[model samples]
Target: MKITLITTGSTADKGPRKVAEYLQKYNHKLEVIFYNENELRQTLSKCKNTDLIVVSANVATHKRASLLIQHLKKLKRPTAYAGIYAALHPEECIKETDLVITAKPAETILELANRLENFQRIADIENLRLKFNKKEIIKNA
Candidate 1:
C-alpha cells in the first residue's frame, strides 16, 4: 500500500521513520513528510493520492493533528493517528481519524496495508483501533 507519514516539527518523533522502514521491508510504498520540511499545503497535498495517511503526533501537537485530520476528513481521506497521545487517548484521536494505531503497531499496520490492498475489512485488525463505527471505537488489544 502507498502511505504518507506525517509528523509535526515540535515532536520530530522517529515513530514514522521506523514504521517507514518496517513497511518498506514488506515492499510497501511510503512517503514521509515533516511539517517543518515543506509548506503545509504541499505536504498535505501529498496525502490526497496515497492509499493511507499515518499522522504521528505526541502531546505537543495534538492540536495540529486535529486540524490536519479535520482537513483530511473533509477530503474523505482514510487516516490513522499514531504516537503516544494517540494510543493513550483513543477517544480523542477517533474524533479526528478513521483509526488509531497502538501497541506493537508495525505488524498490525502491515496487516492493514495488505487488507487495504485486497479491499478487505481493516476494522478488525489487531492493534488498530477503528473509529469508523460510531457505536464503538475498536480498541487496541
Candidate 2:
C-alpha cells in the first residue's frame, strides 16, 4: 500500500522519520513530507494519490496537523493521526482523523496496511468474477 506521512516542525525531529523507516521495511511505499516546506495545496496534491495518509504531530505541530486533517477529510480518504501528540491527546486526534495511533505507531500502521491490502485483493477477485459472469450471460443469451 502507498502511504504518505506528513509532519511539521524542524528536520531534526526523528519520530516521523523513524515511523517511515519502519513502514518501509514491511514493503509499504512511503512518502514523507515535511509540511512546513510546502504549500497546503502542494501537500494535498501529493497526498491525493496515496492509499493511506498518516499525519505526525507533537505539541509544537498539533495545530498544523489539525489544519491538514480538516482539509484531508474533504478528500474522503483514510487518514491516521500519529506521533507524541496523538499518543498523549487521543480525544483531540480522534476528532480529526479516521484512525488514531495512541501508541506503537509503526506496528499499528503496518496492521492497518495489511488489512487494506487484503480487502483490495478480495475486491479485485470479486470484480473479476462479476465480469466473467457478465460475459457468460451474454454468450448464453
Candidate 3:
C-alpha cells in the first residue's frame, strides 16, 4: 500500500517514520510519504496510487484535517488518524477516518505499525474478492 502520512506538528513526524521503518521489515513494498500540511494538500492532488492516508491529531482544531477529509472523500480512499487527541476527540477524527488509533509518544510508533499492518491485510482481502468476482464474471460470459 502507498500511504501518505500527514504530519501536523514536529512530534507527529517521528512516530510515522519509526512505524514505516518497522513495517519495512515485514513488507518492503509498503511505501510511506511524509508530508506537512501544505505539501500534503499539493501531493494529494497529484497522487494516483495512494491506498490510504494517515493524519496526525496534532492538527486538532486546524482546517487542514477537514480539507484533507474532503479530498479523501472525493477520492474514496480509506483513512486513519493517530495521535494524542484521537480518542478524546473521536467525533472529529471519526468524521475523516475509517479507524482512529490513539497513543502517546511512548508507544505511538509501535501501535501505528500494528494498525497499518491490519489495514493492509484488510485491503488485500478486499482486492482478492474483487479479482475473484471479475474472474467469475469472465467465466460466465
Candidate 4:
C-alpha cells in the first residue's frame, strides 16, 4: 500500500516515522511528510497514489486535526486514518476518518501496523476486482 503521512508540529513526526519503518519491513511503500498545518495545505496535491492518509496529533491539537479532517474529507480519499498521542481519543480528532488508532508510543505502533495491514488487504482485493473487470471488458470487446 502507498501510505501518505501528514504530520504537523515536531512531535507528531515520530509516530508516523516509526509506523512507516514498520510498514517498510513488510515491503510496503511509505511516504512521511513532516510539515506544519500551513505547509500541508501548500503540498496537499503532491499526495498521489495514497491508499491511506495518517494524521498525527502530538504536534498540534484537536483543532488542527479537525482542519486536516475537513481538508481530507473534501479530497474524498478512500482510506482516512487518524491517530493521536497523549490523552486524546481518536473521536476528538476527526469523525470522517475510516479508522482511529489511539495509544501510547509502543502500543500505538503495534495497533497502527495491524490497521495498515488490514487496509492493505482491502486495497488488494479492490485492485483485483478492477483488474478482473478490465479483463472482462477487453474480452467482450
Whole-model Cα lDDT of every candidate shown, in order: 0.78, 0.74, 0.51, 0.51
lDDT of 2 by residue, 35-59 (tens): 8735899998999899988888899
- Misplaced by over 4 Å in model 2 are 120-141
For every candidate structure, what is the RMSD over all alpha carbons to the true structure, in angstroms?
2.1, 11.5, 9.7, 10.3
Q: Is candidate 1 or candidate 3 better by lDDT?
A: 1
- Shift in Å, residue 139, candidate 2: 51
Residue-level lDDT tens digits of model 1 in 44-95: 6777788888777788778887787777765566788877778788788877
User: On residues 36-106, what C-alpha lDDT tens digit does candidate 4 reach at each position?
Assistant: 66675664675645766666666345567656666776665543334553235533332445544444433
Q: Taking the candidates one at a time, how many backbone clashes does each contain? A: 0, 0, 0, 0
Question: What's each prediction's TM-score?
Answer: 0.88, 0.80, 0.59, 0.62
Instruction: Please give the ranking of all candidate structures by lDDT, highest first, separated by commas.
Output: 1, 2, 4, 3
Q: How many backbone collisions does model 1 have?
A: 0
| Candidate 3, pairs of clashing residues | none
* lDDT, residue 126, model 2: 14
| C-alpha root-mean-square deviation, candidate 3 | 9.7
For model 1, the run of ten residues with the poorest summed lDDT? 35-44
Model 4 has an lDDT value of 0.51
Q: Model 1 off-target regions past 4 Å? A: 9-12, 36-38
Candidate 3 segments exceeding 4 Å error: 28-37, 59-62, 104-141
